[model samples]
Target: MSPPLRNDRQLSELNTPQRNRYFYGKLMDVLHFDLEQEYLIAEQRRGNRLLLGPGVVCGLQVTVIRSGGERGLRVGPGLAIDGWGRRILVPDEFELLPLRLTDEDGVPAPDDDGPLPRQLILSLCYRECRSGFEPALVPDPLCDGPAHSEAGRWVETYALHVHEGTAGDVVRECMPELGELLHKGRIQEALCLLAADCPELPADPCVVLANVAVGPRGALTITDCLPRPVAPTNRMLLQLLICLNERIEECCRHDTVLLKVGAVRLLMGNGPDAVLDSPDERRVIPRGREPLGFEAEFTGAPVDQASVVMDSSVEVLRDRTPVTLPVAWPAPQRLRCAVRNALEPGAYTVTLRGEGPAITSAAQPPDDAEPLDGEAGRQWPSGDGTPGGNFVFSFQVDR
Candidate 1:
């Protein structure tokens, strides 16, 4: 009988040539990225792209040990890559240490006057890529389809020469079965093994971080991380697929942009605060008096015909009840409110939720508009980059 099929291979075989041209074209044209790095951070200063690769590059000064599963990994001070920043982070706990020199017997050896040269193999596997953000463009079969394409293949032996730790420092090694499962593109299975292990040793062939390549059909480039399944391991993989698609949508839709509130201001009269002295400071307002004023400013992506909504509420600390605030936008994206009629005496927390129109080009219908047959539904704008976020202020209203 034949051996059972692996997930990676099974997926690759399922690829069809269905085109997702709209999203694919936007990603290709709007963003400039490299097919090598795990994530690309556009550098405003140099106009050059910085590559944030996966795995730690330990040099000849520190020692790294398997810290145990999901708890935290340990590294001696040196140079290390920031997973989110996609850049080199400095010395200390988050830093990468130098590689330990070792002798043939797997003992730590004295470092020679210079850095030692060693050849190491780095294994990598392709995960999955999602399509771009055009609501009109249907999901691409080449990428999101059930089958994987050539991109799913593995780079079993990526060779590199560098100073690294000797075998002795590796208190625990990755499970052989774990590597085998991943080698065959059994991602979920490998994650199960990783989660089951106590001290998570470095899973061989960890996920690649910065490399993303465009497919022949203009789909966004994607490469999967090696199996290091932890709690969010599965979630991380799924999010990557979503990110690849959303990024494209973000590129094309400039009319609808997100608005973010960094802080909230309180003014005595019901008017916009020219300069809020203490944003976080809460003041006492008499129960029977003129309405107190509140203001919030925003900064985010540029947009045209942008309308913003600030949903706010004040909770009476005494009764722990919430009263909605009628906060309105005076100009474009500027939020203000006058609290007069319903001012109860007590400690309160004012929460604000800022929403902007869904991002779409002038050519597309408004998000609230109905969809046409076979056309993508309404597209909503996003906050600068985030869809929406919240801001809160605390103060007391007294008799």
Candidate 2:
């Protein structure tokens, strides 16, 4: 069975110059591309619209000529002749040739046959503002979402009107409720009304509220309700680095701290350290750099002044000032110098006794301390059983 003869009449009727122009115009509207350089040349058979190029149309004009012993298709003779003297008896061997024509010099011919460009139609839909609001700008909802161009125009007009301290009578009359709402604390509500009433109004109420809040003695707290934008913090600073280092080591893996009285075993999971050793232990000092102006006030009677010895080399001012001391004579006080330029970042135990005010012994577990587990962990204690009047240590560097 042979395929049906290919006819050009229907093809030509569908592909016309006028139809091609309209299709390209619609394509331009959809893509939002500049159409100045692009135009459509229709391959038309008659007056009706047909296939437009930059595209292809199949099965235009086809004729099959059967000749003796021609088993396959062949092309010969002139450029106008296709598959000359060949038989296309089988459906698989159907052959058709396309005839294409273009305007002179390969340029798209002018489309003056139809209505103007769709862009012109769009321009007519936009109504002009009144004389008083000569530079009024509003978002075109018909445009792509969040019309940025229209929003920018609104911002400019708003700036001008705000500086002038007057919105024209028409604007004031049309939006009396909005004006009243602006004076009140209802900025968001006012913007909603403005957007509903004026299709071209900008969408951001915060900008409008900011301009209104800047006057002398104006209630600027309204601006606080507006969104508070924030910038990222510097997480790589020295203080944060130290805190994170200790927290990761203490919590990610089990470790034990030793004191004179007993040992504390700490395990890591979520929400700070899990105290596996004792439940009574509470976090007295929060982890972070301590603020200045922290003074130790104790009610107990002060002991006699005594010279103290430190296990680690003490950092003293050039003037040889005492870094650690007992409190003032009448009050039980301990004066410990702030940790300055300390290389090791961990807790240290400073043991104090009546032997003439000295760090009688300072202790920290060895760096290669065993992990807390069966048969491998070592017991360590960090403090005396008495909790009163213990010194807390911290260090930080400014970068």
Candidate 3:
């Protein structure tokens, strides 16, 4: 038969030997931090459920040797437990050192290195509930006294910041996982976890909407709500989508753009042509006179030689132009030139006159230009010049 479950609170009250040998046993050795370095430990068996908390807390549990000698593992400084139902356990071997490094106003004094007891400084500040044990240790520099104490305090502060930053990053990056928890009907729990782990998130409408949208699917596709036309009115939507996409990409493997783009396209497609004309759409698409030819003038500097290439529908009007050298000493490094092109009703190409570089025209067809479909619309360079930069311009041709 299995041993009876133990309450964490009661376990905390047990003497070092009893807690270590009888309570924890084999379970005590297995606690560890995940890839994020966040602590995870199995503390108590409450009924069939296993309780886990930060490694610092787990380390506080005493360990007893077979000879009955007990040793309490030091709960390293620089660790703190936050969130509801979270508890902190300090080993009987270690005691709290209450030397405040900062002034009463919370500002650091010139002598204030930071928080003391470098190892115990957790990323987050939390309440400490004493188990009514007498203080067994006092705050002192691990090495020498006073002078080194301040330095140690500074080190503690730095370590705490590092720990907190790391935890915050992990929490932010694991949004999808949090969302998954919510999807599994653990909404309140998920939110609580998020709040406890990442309190930096603002309580705003957008955050609420984002949480709801991501919660059920364990993912969020901003493209669904993204406007079709790229305009000022939809700028906020576009920015928000970009930010979300970046966050999702960084934190989880989810690609918001790929998921939502098709849906956005379909939605925009269903709208009337007039809607297409509206500047309020948020999609990333080229607009203007369909496939219209425009001259791109390069004026600031002098170039030894310049060339152009058309990879898309747009064509270069000028076949060749002289490389104008600058007149002054150390003459302007680059030269100004223009690619004038009147493309066929379809996309066309105009290669530059030299061996240097080429620029592709736009993909959009000109207003008066003819329409070419599929491969027929793409303009390729003839086999004369060497390819340097693949500066292929893109444009669209309307029928």
TM per prediction: 0.26, 0.14, 0.17
Task: Please report how far candidate 3 places residue 307 from its true position, in Å.
Answer: 19
Candidate number with greatest TM-score: 1
Task: List, residue by residue over 1-399, the lDDT tens digit for candidate 3.
Answer: 111222334332222322233345444321221211111212331211222222232222211112233211122332223222233332234321222233322233356444333221122222222233332234235433443321211011111111111111122146787879978998888978755742221121010000001113122122111111111224455788999999988888832110000001101122322212211122222333232232222221222222222322223432232122111212222222222331223332332222222222122232221111111111221121222222223222333
List the global CA lDDT of all models. 0.36, 0.25, 0.26
**Ranking of candidates on TM-score, top first:** 1, 3, 2
Which TM-score value belongs to model 2? 0.14
Residues 1-399 of candidate 2: C-alpha lDDT, one tens digit per residue: 112323323333333232224553464531232222112211322211211111001111212233452211111211110111011111132221110111322122344333212110000001112122222144344553353232111111111011212211111144778778888989999868855731221222111111112223221112211222111123324566889889999888743332122222221122343222332332232334322211222212222223233432222221223244222222233333333332122332222322222222222333332111111112323333232222222222121
Indicate which candidate wins on lDDT: 1
**CA shift at 96, candidate 1, in angstroms?**
57
- Per-residue lDDT over 61-83 for candidate 1, one digit per residue giving the tens place of the 0 to 100 score: 22223333211112233232222
